[model samples]
Structure formats: C-alpha cells, structure tokens
Target: MINTFTKPKRLYQEIGLRLYEELSDSRFSVGDRLPPERDIAERLGVSRAVVREALIMLELMGLVEVRKGSGIYLIKQPTDNSLNNELESTLDNDDVGPFEMMQARQLLESHVAEFAATQATKKDIIKMREALELEKQNIEVLDHNHDADKLFHLAIAEATQNSVLVDLVENLWERRESSPMWKQLHCHITDQTYRKKWLIDHEEILLAIQQKKPDAARMAMWRHLENVKDTLLILSEHKDPSFDGYLFSSNPVQI
Candidate 1:
C-alpha cells in the first residue's frame, strides 16, 4: 500500500519560504515591483487569494509594500533575521485556542460586512454576485474548499473599500487555516445540507449588502458567524481528542 498523507503548514508560510528562497538567490532585487497578484498566482500554481495572503504576510514583515492601484514592490534589502523572526514568532503561537480566534474574526468581519453595505459599488455588487454563484456550485459538490469560502468573505471585505479591514480578515483566515481544529472541522463537515446552509447565509448577507442595508448586513453576518462559532465549538469538542475546553467553551473577548 502506498501511504498517502500530507503535513500541514500555513499557506502564507509556504509562500514566504518560496519568496525567501528567491530573495536569497537574488532572483528578485530590492525595489523590484513584484508581478500582479494574478501573475504570481499563475507562476506559483496557487490561487490569487493565496498569493494575496502571502503578500500580506510579506508586507507585514516589511519585505514588500502594497501600493493600492499600483502593485506590490520589494522593499527591504534581503535579510534573514527579521523575516525569519517574524515567521518564527507567527508559527510559535500555535497553542492559541480556535474559539478565541473565531471571536476575533467575528468582531472584525461583522464590521466589514456593515461597511461593505454602505461602501460597495455597482461593480463590487456584480463581483459579489459572481462569487456567490461560484460558491453555490462549489457547495453543491460538498467539497471543503476553505479557500473558496474565504474568497466569498474577502470579496465582501474588498467591497468595503477598507484596506485595513481587508488586510485583517485575510490575515485572520490565513491563521485559521493553520489551526488543527479548523482542519478537523473541514474533515467532519462533508454534508451538503451544512454546505448549503452556509451558502444561504452568505446569500442573505450579500443581499443585505447589495441593498446597502448596513444594519441588516451587519446582523446577518453576525448571525451567520454565530452559527459558525456554534458549529466549530461542537465539532472541536466532539472530534479532536486533544482539544482543551478553551477550543469550545471560551466566551468572546469584548472588543
């Protein structure tokens, strides 16, 4: 029998490692404008969202700067210590509870949904609709494509025209992807009913945002995430043998 299994690393960490290798080999120089996100996605065989997440990590480490409406550009003279330290510190905090992270996500993403209701444009609405259609098709397959789910949420954040919130949500999703609890949830959540319910919740939020109903959108998103929180809490408790109570029982940190 051929053993088939895979080790897990955060998407951004993998991207960061590849970037570090390139920088070390002088494949890209300081001040060089990195290719557009789509181009990088093609080159790396990863989704544009993954590239964007990686770029955010790079930006956080001061290795690159993203200029809105321009493009990402290399910044630091290639050095190992700061970038390595940043990555290490990020990876080292692996013990943080999943519910705690979900609480943070709920607080930030709900606000973004509210802002998106007020700020989204006609173009943004169209993009959101397209994402929803894709989400509907994907959910029908009952596949656990967290990346697809993430894109739907990120599209809403992007529509908010709030770069800070967009960056924050992207980083949050990246961190969530690294958690074993999240991995376990993905494995257990194979039911089409569960998938469809999430899709319906996404559509409800999108409709509120489309109508520019800020309060409605905010509440819808809050309700949707509350469901997510509840499901995660249940799954984390039931499935993961090593999970401590914090993964399920902790209350949200008041913002």
Candidate 2:
C-alpha cells in the first residue's frame, strides 16, 4: 500500500517534525538504529534531501547520533537549552541590529557575569585577568582586534561555570563577525583614546565581577552597552543614510 502523506510546504521543517514524531515513539529506544535515508524518503514520499535535512535538525536537537559509516542511531531524549537556541535564531536572521544584539548580550551576559562572580574558580579568574591585560595592551596600539574582544567576553562566560552560556556567547561573537554595525563601528572609531576608554570600562566590569558583586557587574554591563549604543548612533548619523529600516529601528532587545 502506498503511503498517502503529502510533502510538507516547508520541506525541512515538515521532515524534521515527522522525524521528531517517529523518534518520540517508545519503540525507538536509545541506541536504536534508524532506517537508511533511502528507506525513510520512500516511506515518507519525500526526497532524500528532505530526509537528510530532517536528520540534521534531529541531530541539532540532540535526538539522534549520525555516525558516518555506521548509520544514524537514537541517542537520547532532546533537551532545549534556551540561550543556545536563541543565539542560533539570532545568527540566522540577516537584519539583526546592534541594539538588538546588545540587548541580548545585556540580558545574557549580565546574568552570566553575576553567576561568574559567585562561581568562578581560581583558573577562571586568572584567565579573565589575562584576557583583560591583553585588551589593555591592544588599546595602546589602537588596534580593533575582534578576536581579543571576543576572547575577553568568552572568558567571562566561562567564569560562569556554565557550558551552555559559554557556547551562547561564542555563537554571538561569531554572529558579530558578519554584523553591519560591528563593521561600521570599527571603521568609524579608530582612535587610541576611544580604545583606551573602552578598555578602562571593561576593567571596571572585571573589577566588579572579581569582587563578587552581582549588582555592580550588571550595572557595569548596562553602562558599557549604553556607550556602545551611543557610538553606533553617532556613526550611523554621519555616514549611513539610515534608509534601511533595519538600521534605525530601536528594537535592540526584542530580537
């Protein structure tokens, strides 16, 4: 008998949902081998590509393990890490603004700093201090080293003692590499004085966290983001026409 299921409008999502449902059945226990791609495509009346896409989604959700030569197997039940999921979503959107990115960083990193203050081990604190020192040196050279900046942030995230938050912060930094605002800000602000000021602000943030003061850390992050916002606004006003609605909108936090 022919299966009567029609192909889904969004093939990837439809395939993902179908795979998710199939995997959810108790019969598909952990480590159970999944049917081959061809078999799945035939059974679902969809192309092999759709099945593959679905499988990728399943892998991302932590539902299945894909072994190159051994085929796919059920791994474990899926668990959502909200911060990682949000970072992934933000990375996928091309129009994400600086404000939105800052807002996300503000929400996630402020809490991360607070946690890091309480949870940081000696090694974590040492790494953070090292990163801060590197940032300080870079400021003297007036170099806009995105890598160093990201490393500093990642060190703070690591101090939180949360792997999930570390991953989220890393992902956000990756997204920033392609961000229009990031590119523009680097081009517009190239002075050593500005770099020194930014480094000093970061130092204050680190000091607050080192003191294990949650409130101080949160306020420091807020002030730093506010400074970033002001800098971006000044640049946007001078060069860019702001004709693109995406550039001027203030939904920095909601994205």
- Candidate number achieving the greatest lDDT relative to the actual structure: 1
Write candidate 1's Cα lDDT for 131-219 as tens digits.
Answer: 88878777667655656688889899999888888899998888887765345334434334666777789999999998899999988
Residue 210 deviation, candidate 2, in Å?
A: 1.2
Global lDDT scores for all candidate models: 0.67, 0.63
On a 0 to 100 scale, what is the lDDT of residue 140 in model 1?
Answer: 68
TM-score of model 1 (CA atoms): 0.56
Clashing pairs in 2: 99-252, 100-252
In model 2, state the lDDT of residue 137.
73
The numbered model that scores best in TM-score is 1
Per model, state how many residue pairs clash: 0, 2
Residue 122, model 2: lDDT of: 78
